[model samples]
Target: SNIDFNPVEDEDSSRILFEIKCHFNLVSEKNNDEYKLENRKLRFVYLSKLNDEVTDDKKLLDEIEKFYDNQGYPEDMNTFIEYMPQDSYTNCKILILRFHEFLNLEGEQLRLI
Candidate 1:
């Protein structure tokens, strides 16, 4: 009797799975508008990561192609990926603003003398 349980043993694959899970959690916590926008933004990151690998998984390959079709990017995905760093910076600023709000620090004076 053989069981068909395929656990991800490869370190890189496991790391990718963990990252995707984390990303999914972050996206799911947002409101509908935020979720849609973040989901599309993060899809670019995944596309860039997967583009570097030589994979034989037809399903994944097909999904990648479908993404290009749906997104209508140029032939080179890197051209679009170049914008991620700035996008990440903007997201960090938003997070910092939220953090300050959570701490009730908005419009407050910090005296460090």
Candidate 2:
């Protein structure tokens, strides 16, 4: 025996599936506020590895120079990474500060994990 599917139903389901896929891609591509906050934190850690002292400000200011000397990161991207903090915060303070900074930079934006 042969089975046949309804053309209209198949078309509708296909459209829905396509829409779902597009929505998922959109969510994945855009950096949510939380993700951006996390990125900042990671950036701090990366900077710390480059510095003699692990303070955020010092690391931030010196990262690009270190990277340039080390030839690790592209030179053009240096300016984007050049904000140095005056002092280092404890881990908890760092988290809070990061969250606060994130909120200020991206007010009330929802980010996808």
Candidate 3:
């Protein structure tokens, strides 16, 4: 039987996975009502697409799935977009995610690989 457990092997991929996991943990731990007025708790976390040759949305989604599955998703993972100002007439679209403290089998904030 062929199992598609695509483990994060490449250094770049590994770094990305670690960064994302840390981001989730940070956001979850700092999730408070006062700071959540407009979901400002996750403003500094994101995944960049500007450097990747694989520009397809579907492929990116698959990569995210593989990373999450291999590394394990956080309890209350919430994903969103963070718009960063780059220059005039331009803004960087950063992918941000926050892990919640609910619906977790392991009852953890994050599991980084």
On TM-score, the candidate that comes out on top is: 3
For model 2, what is the error of residue 16's alpha carbon versus the real structure, in angstroms, after optimal superposition? 33
Candidate 2 segments whose C-alpha is farther than 4 A from its true place: 1-26, 53-113
Question: What are the per-residue Cα lDDT tens digits for candidate 3 across 1-113?
Answer: 64333334455555654465565554542254433322221221222221133355545445544444443443223241122222234212333112111213212322220
TM-score of 2: 0.26
Candidate 1: where is the Cα deviation over 4 Å?
1-31, 55-60, 63-113
Task: State the displacement of the C-alpha of residue 96, model 2, in Å, after optimal TM-score superposition.
Answer: 25
Q: Give candidate 3's root-mean-square deviation (CA, Å).
A: 14.6
- The deviation in Å at residue 73 for candidate 2 is 11
Best by lDDT: 1
| Candidate 2 lDDT score at position 76 | 33
Q: Tell me how far the alpha carbon of residue 42 in candidate 1 is from the true structure, in angstroms, after superposition.
A: 1.6
State each candidate's clash count.
0, 2, 1
lDDT of 1 by residue, 1-113 (tens): 64343322345434654465576665443345545444444544445444434244443444454554554543433222323333344443343343234223311322121
lDDT of each: 0.41, 0.40, 0.34
**lDDT per residue as tens, model 2, 1-113:** 53342222334534544454465454542245544344344434333343323346544344434543443354333333333332453443454355346434433242332
